[model samples]
Target: MEPHVWPLYGLRITTPRLELRLPDLDTLSDLAAVAAAGVHDEDEMPFSVPWTDGTPGERGRSTFQHLLGTVAAWTPGAWTLSLAVRSEGEVVGRQDVGANDFAVTREAVTGSWLGQTYQGRGIGTEMRAAVLHLAFEGLGARYVTSAAMTDNARSLRVSEKLGYHPDGLEVLSVRGEARTFRRLRLDRAGWEAHRTVPVELHGLEPTLALFGL
Candidate 1:
């Protein structure tokens, strides 16, 4: 898949144990399969959107379409960069960095999910560190934000490990029930202070304009 027409496809961000890139068609299928295999316990809903509550096939198809939709709906003023997270050359999950009016606001938000089999190994922290590097270093972003359910200790731990601080809380209707979520934020100073992972960016230069850089 040549990226001559879509340079974002060429952008890549790598950490010690993971590689993050926009998936081509073939890799997208593998990523969709990872979603089909499952990300969290059925009784638990970590995401506000219940896209994963569907059947196995539905989960996979939804994952596939969501990534495609990100590409289709992208604009200079608002965009979602959904990168497929690969470890040991296999797709393990996805890491997303998104923003609106990034050039002026200089803020980006992140969201992600890892396969159930890949959790609890610190991969979550490492993958996020990789994207924070892109957001702050590669794209000159001043702040990055994330949110997770208040009970989602794993996700909150990951954010804390990466230097994010509590911003606020939100009450949302998840699956028709009230859910409490914690908002977190990290500025450039905090990101620089907590930098530990050695991340490498490739092909980001060409995609900078698309991010309104």
Candidate 2:
């Protein structure tokens, strides 16, 4: 973890009960195992990409490869931070924050998943809050966006609690079928208004350039 070449590995976002950081190989393996154990019910898919619709082994492999792909494809103008979310000192999930031409737009998008065993504990909200803090406070972002399936009440509820307003709607093909998603957006004022979690960002200075800040 010297982060000599990829300084993003040095960034850390901490909530009162969770810590989010880019995973190293070993930590990445643990995160993949969490995915293998399952993040959602077998009958339903929350992601628009249908990435979780696979065998347990395939799901794990996909998680591993996707995280690596983000790192390999990164640029200062467009980058994704796939952070392993840890609670009680163990990896429990993953949180992703990304932007396209962030220096010009000053906007970012967030996504996340938690192991089935770790759900319903408010970990999701805390982790997302940590990233929002990084975007608005640490990086001077003006807006953060998210989207959840229309039927994903849990995700929509989280967005509402975080002071996000419905921005629009879109339909996409998932699993060979059309699915609708509710788009949510939060501006700096909204984020500051609903900020409840105490977040601490560490080592972000070294990685600011990586985010095109």
Candidate 3:
């Protein structure tokens, strides 16, 4: 818990209603359970990776393994901050903020998933605002980017509320079909303009170098 080796474990991003942090083992297990319970309608795949298209047990295991893999695979040039999203003291989902060559590009990407039960409560926007705060305000990032399946209206709406503009579209093969994704981008100006939620960054100073800042 002290994060003596990987200082990133100490970083925290908080909004008025949510806390996002690297999960300890017990917290990670709870997060895995959230995934097992489901993040989207079974009939629709919101993610490009189709990572949730398996048995509940498999989904849980994959969630656990993917977070571990992010930690194991991290480097200064490329890294993912896979944080568990907790609201009212309960694990509700995961939020990831990551980048490659951040020192040079000053850009990052965001991704997330909330348990099916937790969606549509505005938690998604607040949770994302927390990380956008960390990226632009805490880390001096110039821009942030994200993408969602074109049909994912909720996600696109969240992005729009956060001041992200349509960057373009990309077609990707998903679930054996060609799916289009609406790419979104936000710059420092846009992030500052749409900042609604109050976000606090904790224990990030020690992890700046790890982000290549």
Candidate 4:
């Protein structure tokens, strides 16, 4: 019998020290454990959505469910490629590259989180570069966008380093409190010119249509 494969079964994005790919059940469980350990400190909430606001076990369960939902709800016009980020063959975090109305917009959004233990290193930047490569080169995306809380200097800096231009701001309610977020965007030319990491993608042909490419 043939091995069960997902729409993006064998897709992968690799950097010098990291690998990003769709997580299988076992890998997803490992990813959940990492998330359960925690991402940010208890007092802080970096994401607009408080997905990690619950208990550690709850966070892990939520991570697992969210990833599964993305796959089950996928459509040609909308998709969320939630790839597990691994370092040295161990699940460390998650990097999500997503799109809406991609067939018409040709635009994508990127979001990610690293385990607290992995925060200060340059891993976040490198992982993002891999996804950017997959977006513009592998998926033929025309533009990519991202957002960071106004206070999230690390995230904003990563976007700046990748040549994403400031696209103004938006206010959103986070945990019942209103907060300002800085929006950023990068075009194909800008991404190509600023991209430095050499990324390799494997087995994306069968899933290209699912992303409306």
Candidate 5:
């Protein structure tokens, strides 16, 4: 079946140097290429899913399929907005903001990755801030959460910079072994109190219900 298009077409979040948007086919392909070029080394797994564990082509294909699947599986109670991040008009990475039963929970989750070439340039932080702006400001979310392997310091730092507090920890088996992760949470008040980026969101009202809001 063809995926349902979000009611909020051209929904955009922009910072001074970057733009984040739900991508069309052309842009999605660009995003796939970014994944193929490498976000991290094959021997190193930064995500819980090990989505990048295969060959380079497989990694790219998985990214493309996952983004498309989110659109195909969208519903009022759950949704995933896998947005392409553009810098100076070129696709640089992906940023995702999503919710499960948002109306009842008023919560969402954020995830992202930047091309290795783009790391250390503040793009990850900026992109994350853009999504936080959308979650709390545009969608009226009360809380946001995320998780990372305990050893992933860079990710933990980003969460800290954005005002998320360490909520707790969990142990989940991955790749045939037990892995411990740190869970983080940020309430709206905390987000507003620590926000430092200036972000503008467009075309969100019509898509609010897609997140069960």
Candidate 6:
């Protein structure tokens, strides 16, 4: 991508085993195919939006449109960095870190999903470490927040592994019934204490202004 026109596309975050970047159209299509194959079973939803409930085609379209929309609608005051997670050479998942009035609040929220076949490995944990590295060390964010359904043990485990303290819980309607969720938070000090992975930021200098840095 042309950095002058869309500098966010030039941003990259990497861990020892993973590389995250804004996917070009062709790579986005590949990521969409991963979504189309399936992200979870028909029974449970780890996400609040229920984006994976439909047919494979519908899920793929939702993934593509949601990501593209975030890029189109971004502004420095409020934006979502939705980067495609790459392992080895394959597009495996998506990770997001977003904020509103970030320059003032110095806070951001994280969200993500992985294809079903890729779930059991430690990729979710490593990719998350990459973005948290971007938020605190790269962007000078003071805090990051995330939530997971109470029944979603894997997501909770990832948060726990990353040194996020359980802030509290909330109830929400999902699919149909009420669901309880665990809210987690990590401050810069906490992240520094428990961060276990080595992460690197590249192409970040040119994108600082876009993040209100």
Q: Rate the local accuracy (lDDT) of all candidates.
A: 0.95, 0.94, 0.94, 0.91, 0.89, 0.93
**Which portions of model 4 show Cα errors greater than 4 Å?**
1-5
Q: Give the TM-score of candidate 3.
A: 0.99
lDDT of 4 by residue, 31-124 (tens): 9999999999999999999999989999999999999999899988888999999999888899999999988898999999999988888889
Q: Candidate 2 lDDT, tens digit per residue, 58-132?
A: 999999999999999999998999999999999999999999999999999999999999999999999999999
- What is candidate 6's CA lDDT for residue 94? 95
lDDT preference between candidates 1 and 4, better one: 1
Give me the candidate number with maximum lDDT.
1
All candidates: TM-score: 0.99, 0.98, 0.99, 0.96, 0.95, 0.98
Higher-TM-score candidate among 2 and 4?
2
Task: Evaluate model 2: give its lDDT.
Answer: 0.94
User: Compared with the true structure, what per-residue lDDT tens digits does model 1 show for residues 26-100?
Assistant: 999999999999999999999999999989999999999999999999999999999999999989999999999
lDDT (Cα, tens digit) per residue for candidate 5, span 1-213: 122455644588999999998888888889999999999866777788888777779988998999999988988888888999999999999999888888898899999999998998989999999999999999888999999999989999999999999999999888878889999999988899889989999877776667776
Query: How far in Å is the alpha carbon of 48 misplaced in model 1?
Result: 1.0
Deviation of model 4 at 126, angstroms: 0.8
Angstrom error at residue 140, model 2: 0.5
Listed per model in order, the count of residue pairs whose N, CA or C atoms clash below 3 Å is 0, 0, 0, 0, 0, 0
Q: Provide the lDDT at 183 for model 3.
A: 98
Error of 1 at 182 (Å): 0.4
Writing each residue's lDDT as its tens digit, candidate 3 over 1-213 gives 777788988888888799999999999999999999998988999999999999999999999999999999999999999999999999999999999999999999999999999998999999999999999999899999999999999999999999999999999999999999999999999999999999999999999889887
User: Which residue ranges in model 2 land beyond 4 Å of their true spot?
Assistant: none
Please tell me which model should have the higher TM-score, number 2 or number 5.
2
Candidate 1 ranges beyond 4 A from true positions: none
